[model samples]
Target: MKVELVQLAGRDGDTAHNLARALEAIAACAADTDLVVFPETHLMGFPTRDTIAALAEPLDGPTLQAIAQAARAHDIAIAIGMAERDGEHYYNTTVLMTPQGIALRYRKTHLWASDKGIFTAGDRYATALWKGVRVGMLICFDIEFPESARALGQLGAELIIVTNGNMDPYGPTHRTAIMARAMENQAFAVMVNRVGTGDDGLVFAGGSAVVDPFGNLLCEAGREACRQVMVLDFDRLQAARNDYRYLDERRLTLPGERIEHADGRRELMIPQDSF
Candidate 1:
């Protein structure tokens, strides 16, 4: 499948501007592009305590609906992040959108720094079928945890997508993590990080990248706005398993309650560690 990574800046709490920018990028994708991905919190940019509640939208809110429409209009799928408000609680979430509506929604399970108090941690790792590909998602900080991708790998994810908002001095961190994650799971990995500055004055890093199942860097961008198209070779992905299968040959498995949805989505309810 042809995937497009959009690395652009977003104004914190400015949903109007962010939505417009996201839509324009969707409309401008190349004809054969199958999926388009944006950086973390692209919808609400990194909401502050004062603006989080006001800017955060529910899963059924207008912002996601608009994205669903764009997916249909362009005959493509989109994976973008937002500040999701769910009644009494809020989440830093990412959703995969198709013409039919939301195919997958994953809340950031690993909150970074201040996010611990800002959003509730998700308890499950999920994946959904996207045009024959078993696709899973990870938010910015989630990539730092090895178990995060392993959960999805156990669920049979062939492609792992990370929507990131990593800032200065930490761009290299994610760059290394993405490659390792792909190689460790023998799955294709892609990350799209934002550029420019946010409300907190942290400059969002823009080193978005794509790694093949063999852990080769196929495409990469620097600290500037960029858009790139990458075609995934499923044959190569399959090749990664020919010699050895990590999931099959592994000595241990994660403890979780695996759920299989009728619509082809899978989730692993991670068991909380007890003291």
Candidate 2:
């Protein structure tokens, strides 16, 4: 599938401008593209805890609706992160919207330091089918944790789309994390981070990139304003799996079932049967 990563400027608390820029990127990359990924909270800049709480909006609010409209018009799928308001509580949510409409929603499971008090943790990882491919979704900080990507990989996801608004401090560390997660899980991973300064003191490093199942760097962006489209060849990914049966050999045993884990950390996480 032709997967595109869009890294753009997200103005703090400016949902309107953010939505407009996101739609514009989707429209620009629509041609010959199957899915487009945006940065975490691309709608509301990654503000401080207090600002994020105030900017949180309902799932069906205008920001999400605007993204859906853009997907429909472009005839492509979109995965984006936003501050989702559910009643009195809110979550760092990532919504996967298809041309037809919203396919699935996955909240960030691993919350950052300040996010602990600001956003609700997700119950589990979720995947949605888009154009015959199993697409997994993860928000910014969620991808930093190995368990998040492994959760999706265990569920038979072929591609994991990560939307991040990663801070600038540990740029290389976070960038390596993407490849590490992808290589360990044997799934194609795509990351889209933001650029420019926001209302807060944080600076975002736009090192948005895509990696193959073997951890090969397909495409990567520097610390600059960038928007690029790269093809995630399904056949090539399958070939890698066929050549090396490592992923299929790894195993994780749950209460009522056992599964494969390319790495040996199978005993750490609880299985579905246990739950």
Best by TM-score: 1
lDDT for each residue of candidate 2 in 153-224, tens digit (9 for 90 to 100):
777778888888888796787789999888878889999998888766778888999999888888889877
Give the poorly placed runs of model 2, Cα more than 4 Å off.
253-275
Instruction: Give the TM-score (vs. native) of candidate 1.
Output: 0.98
In candidate 2, list every pair of residues with a backbone clash: none
> Which run of 10 residues does model 2 get worst, by summed lDDT?
260-269
Clashes within 3 Å, all models in order = 0, 0
lDDT of 2: 0.79
Per-candidate Cα RMSD to the true structure, in Å, reads 1.0, 4.9
In candidate 2 the C-alpha lDDT for residue 141 amounts to 78
For residues 1-275, write the lDDT of model 1, one tens digit per residue: 99999999989989999999999999999988999999999998998777888989999899988998999999999999999999889999999999888999999999998797788888899999999999999999999999999999999999999999999999999999999999989999999999998878899889999999988899999999989899999898779989999899999999989999999999999788810
Best by lDDT: 1
